[model samples]
Target: VLRDERCTNLSSLIFATIFFGNLAFRAYYSRKM
Candidate 1:
């Protein structure tokens, strides 16, 4: 159960990182344009 929770947390963290990264990249590109 603990291992499962850890995996879930890691997945969520990765998802959030990707989400934010995409947003940042979009903003950067928009600024450049």
Candidate 2:
């Protein structure tokens, strides 16, 4: 149970990081173009 909880938290953190990273990239790309 504890291991599952830890995995869930880690996955969410990674997902949030990727989501924000994608948004930032899009903003930068649009500004450059």
Per-residue accuracy of model 2 over 1-33 as CA lDDT, tens digit each: 999999999999999999999999999999999
Give lDDT per model, in order: 1.00, 1.00
| Model 1 agreement with the true structure over 1-33: per-residue lDDT tens digits | 999999999999999999999999999999999
Candidate 1 to native Cα RMSD, angstroms? 0.4
TM-score of each: 0.95, 0.87
Which pairs clash in the backbone of model 2?
none
Candidate 1 backbone collisions, by pair = none
Give candidate 1 regions above 4 Å deviation: none
In terms of lDDT, model 1 sits at 1.00
